[model samples]
Target: MRSEPTDAERALWKLLRAKRFSGYKFKRQVPIDRYIVDFICFNHRLIIEADGSQHAENAYDEARDSYLSQQNFRMLRFWNNDILTNTEGVSEAIWTALQDETSTPSPQPLSRKGRGALEGAHNG
Candidate 1:
């Protein structure tokens, strides 16, 4: 539960929450340790960050991105204005990135079932 992200983050959240895009579940304001990310899809180890001008001066953010990359997470960052105005293009870019089979990161998130938890899901 993130303190409701910025306007730009909210806009993208609307498009990502509830598996709305390509049926992937993206969590908002997820805290991996001390930092909270705008969106994280653990299934694909994909992180979507919508950055504002302040991010330009945040050296800490750069360090975080590098750490995430080293942890096998693919970080996709979009400028706030770009995401707010060109949602379709943003979505397309995400789709295209996901479809890059040759460069797709491996060791995908394991299924809950593999760990003996069924997510309390009831099958019909």
Candidate 2:
């Protein structure tokens, strides 16, 4: 797969390689257990799979999805046509998924009085 990437894969790689997609590092053709994923971001626990016509309703892919879900890894699949024709849409979806995985709610701010009390405690 590394030596011969499909046109769609090659196109996506241009956007995803070298932490270019939202500063998240993505490895291509990564081995996970018994399967080799097309692209994976370990930091976000996300897998991006580029599927061709042959992958339609593939039973093996269903099993793969179930297994990855059990392991807390989210998978985003895109058809070769979508990747090639609507690259922006595919990239946007990937970015949204990445944000969903990594974003955390902001902490509540301390009031002025609370800050004073904490400062006094630390100074004393």
Candidate 3:
């Protein structure tokens, strides 16, 4: 994404995109506005940013995070070293975050009724 993802990011991508964690599709170098997210899963409205060391002291990063937050996009960041060094853990973390809350209602199902039937949520 950013000038050929850093080593850690590259390694993490190897594991993340392998379908080890099924149902999660991650795109590299996805352009969102002026910023290009390292990975994004639209179904979950999640953006994953692989931070190289420069992020810790970056004021711009804070503002950027704030703006993304306001836009209702959840940002998940992983340090290059951590992701590269501990890919299994990273995968676990990503999967955990991706899980939908069971307490919340799942999407309503579509009705199979004829045209005469009223359109209503066929919530399962």
TM-scores, one per candidate: 0.76, 0.79, 0.73
Q: Model 1 Cα displacement at 82 (Å)?
A: 0.6
lDDT of each: 0.66, 0.69, 0.59
Instruction: Mark the regions of model 2 whose C-alpha exceeds 4 Å error after superposition.
Output: 102-124
lDDT of candidate model 1 versus the reference: 0.66
> Which stretches of model 3 miss by more than 4 angstroms?
1-3, 18-20, 100-124
Which window of 10 residues has the lowest lDDT sum in candidate 2? 115-124
- Give a tens-digit lDDT track for model 2, residues 1-89: 46899998998889899989878999999989988899999988888877675665567777777777667777777766667777777
In candidate 3 the C-alpha lDDT for residue 122 amounts to: 13
Tens-digit lDDT string for candidate 1 (10-107):
89989998989989889888888766778888877777777666665466876777667677777667777767777777787677656653353332
RMSDs, each prediction? Answer: 13.0, 16.5, 15.4
Q: Candidate 2 clashing pairs?
A: none
Q: Whose TM-score is higher: candidate 1's or candidate 2's?
A: 2
Clash totals for all candidate models: 0, 0, 0
Residue 9 displacement (Å), model 3: 1.5
